[model samples]
Target: MFRFTDYGEEDAIRLCKELVRIESTDPGSYEGRISEYIYETLRQELGADGVRLCRSEVLTGRRNLLAELPGSSAPAGSGKEEPALVLICHMDTVVAGEGWSEETGGPFSAAERDGRIYGRGSCDMKSGLACALTAFCREAGERRLRQGEKAPEKYRTLRFIASVDEEDFMRGAERVIRDGWVSASDWVMDLEPTDGRIQNCHKGRVWFEAEAEGVTAHASMPEQGTDAILALSYFICALREEVAKLPEDERMGRTTITFGQITGGYRPYVVPDHAKVWIDLRTVPPTDSRMLRELLGRAERAATEKVPGSKFRILLTGDRQSIPPCPKSRLLQSLRQAVREATGEEAVVSLFPGYTDTAVIAGTLGNENCLSYGPGKLRLAHKPNEYVDISDIRRVMRVLRCLLREPLR
Candidate 1:
């Protein structure tokens, strides 16, 4: 098994700092600028080991820059084999709007202070991405001595899949599937900011819309028209009560529903006849979504029973399932070893409360053997002044290197 202490600290810090300087966020302002930066860095700096760039269809100016240094003791074509372990990282950040004055100069301006790198994506992902890069780069560098006719036939392929658009739509990973980039592999190691924890579970979302129709009447004539707002409030309360009782799963915890938005009013002089609200449902396993439709029927009945003249309707605006706990016992055990090799401490793991692009990989790939590891504190994701631990990046880098070099038994 490979260990975390194998990789150099200086290398990890360099990769993280350079990427942080690019400010690659949502619809990265400098898409070409950032992609080209990687291209030049690897092609020029590590070209001796043979680095290749793979363009993606997701971002126009950007691309999934892949660097592969043919392993020593690996089959000729084995360098691109299935069930292959991939180092996944994104090249984008949320909008850096505020709370970055303490950083270099602005939100995108990265600063290293007190061992933490301060910036927009410093904590959310850039750190993890850098870790993956460092480990893979070391392998890339190691290839210099293993290339040509003397290279070994048994070797692990270290891939650096740096993509774009993970901040918003996750179009990067989506495009990777559409174009069959990683389809050959059973699973990919999603390098997100997990505070060096292994994540294999997360909650998904179901967006629905509920409408309450009411009659309009003059405000002065209280008995003339129906109050849609009042009807909506009553409907909301019933929905809340019904949603509160949703069953819970041991892995993802209890399912939940919340009223995200509501708007319905015609005029100040008239009672609102139209009221609509958006309901968001966080689902867990064994909880069938079809049951929600049944709940809607009950809600309508309750509304009708409460207000004889009031009418209601429900629509399934959106439906997305949470990626269940794959928890591949063997894979987790292997990863635990990797984590130990990557960090001196025991691997910290838990279910990710929110959603992740891992859903895409889990669906397209296998789940049982799937595992996630990366740098950056998840608590900083999507928040202002998000930063990653510079030292943490190096630590994970060391771990990734060992994982790639570890021989298949």
Candidate 2:
């Protein structure tokens, strides 16, 4: 068993601050620089063979970093091997937009105040990344020190995956699964700033674009041409009414929809010929792509019937399935015990309201042994002047260290 001191809390905090200073915003640097930094850091500690970069096919220059610590073979004649544990953390952050107080020292300042580290991605997840990195490096270093000393205790293989593009499409996670880095039997965990809660499930997410086309007409002409903007507005109202009819889930609550972006007419003197809206839906169980398509079809028919010349179409942008709660999960039980041992407090099990890489990993592999547990609060993510408590980072490190020390079943 490994002690908490094996990975110093102070070291984890320092690494978190350093990571916060790097501007690895999504759609900006796109995790290129941060991936390189992590790759080089792990290579230095675990050697080049233990760490490698997997470039993303969808995004240029962006890559995922994988670091592995292989475990000893099971005892002779056991006829079974321990399942591997995959720890995932994304290296990208949402853009650090304008608004910030002077105390924050700008978006990439990595400033410290009130025992918290402030900057973009500090709370969203850089702190969790630091904890994972520290724990992995420390465990690898310890193993190296104990080489050739009798028979080492058997442990599960540990894989640390630093993915890119989690803030946008989760293309990095898709690539990781496609590349066979994670198996169906392996347990997956994403460090996604869950406020130290053990989140075993998350809501489904679907993003689609609705385009409405109509004939342009002069402002003085009434009923001469259908208004594309009015048609899309009618569709939006119809969709909301349809979604309101969906039954609410006990754990995940009701499915909700949000209009993220809308573009319509440019000038006031003319009726626009084209209009579009980007819709985001947070879905519950029993809601799949087929159901979504039907819902959109109904709404489109409603709009077309109301506006004679308007034609509507939908383009799906992204889809991520919801993960249901696993109350009897062995991984959940083990993690809860580790949390109790590390913090002397019971772990609170809840559903993560937002989607995470664990959702993609679990859904793609049909693996129920997946969860999210980490430092910082989810509310702080994607906001300016974001910060993570230093104590929270230390606590997560302690909990993760305890969990990693135990043998996987």
Candidate 3:
């Protein structure tokens, strides 16, 4: 067992500041430097064989770093191995837009004041990354040393995955699966910004684009040609009405729909012949991928019925599965215990409204033993002047220390 004080507050805050300084924003930004930093740190702590980089397929030289802490030793003569525990942290941050210079210094300033670290990725993720990395180091340090060291004790193997592209297509998560870093029996924890709550479940999403086709004509005579934009509007209305009727989930609340983007018409003078609407459908349990696709088909059919001669096609973008709430599990119990030990109160469990890479890893790795728990408020992520409470970061470290106290069996 390890002490909760093994990793201190000062070191955690310092590392978090260092991570926020690295501009790993998405869309053309590369996670190479941050991944390298994590890899180098883990390699130094766990040795060369214990850490490796899982390169991304879409991004050149981009990689997801994985580190393993095999503990001090293995269970004696059991022949059966302990279930592995995996910790996941995303390395990318959203694009830091304007209006951040004077208000919060800058997106990458890593400025500290009044017990908060202000920066672009500070709250959204860097804080979580720091927690995961620090926890990994502490666990690895538990192994028996060679020089003047006592006999090693057995503990479950621990793994860390610093993934990339979480702000976009999630290719980094796919890379981990391709590299075979995850296993079925492994328990996974995604260190997302949760404001000290334990998120055992989250709503999923089905993203797709629907294109409406129509006949074009001069703007002077609107009746002479079919307006694709008008047809798309009809479809959107019908979709909203249909989604409003879907049964609400007790935990996830409701199946929400968002028209993220719409594009049509080259100029005002001509009636556009084609229009496309990007739809984001938040899903819950009993509403699997196939059901969502069918619902889209029905919505399209309803739109065609409302506006004759308007043909449409739904192009699939993504379908992330909704994670079921793990209300009763040893890991969940352990997490609650950790929270109480750290803060003298039980963890507030809640449903995550946004999609996370946990779904992708769980689906691909064939393990539902995954959840999210960490520091920072969920609302502050991706906003201007983003920041995470330094106290919350320290509290998270204490909880992690408690959770990592003993090896999983």
Best by TM-score: 2
Candidate 1 Cα errors over 4 Å, as ranges: 1-7, 24-33, 45-51, 59-65, 68-82, 97-105, 148-153, 209-231, 258-279, 300-318
RMSD of each: 4.7, 3.1, 3.5
State the lDDT at 212 in candidate 3: 98
Q: Per-residue lDDT for 221 in model 3?
A: 94
Q: On residues 283-384, what C-alpha lDDT tens digit does candidate 2 reach at each position?
A: 998886779899999999999998888998799988899889989887899899999999999999998999988899888889889999999999988887
List where candidate 2 sits over 4 angstroms from the true fold.
1-6, 48-58, 73-79
Query: For each candidate, what is the lDDT?
Result: 0.69, 0.86, 0.80
Q: Estimate each model's TM-score.
A: 0.81, 0.94, 0.91
The better-scoring model by TM-score among 1 and 2 is 2
* Per-residue lDDT of model 1, residues 325-383, tens digit only: 75555556667787787666688667876555566666555445555777777888877
TM-score of 2: 0.94
lDDT of 3 at 385: 89
> How many clashes does the backbone of model 3 have?
0
Which 10 consecutive residues of model 2 have the lowest summed lDDT?
49-58
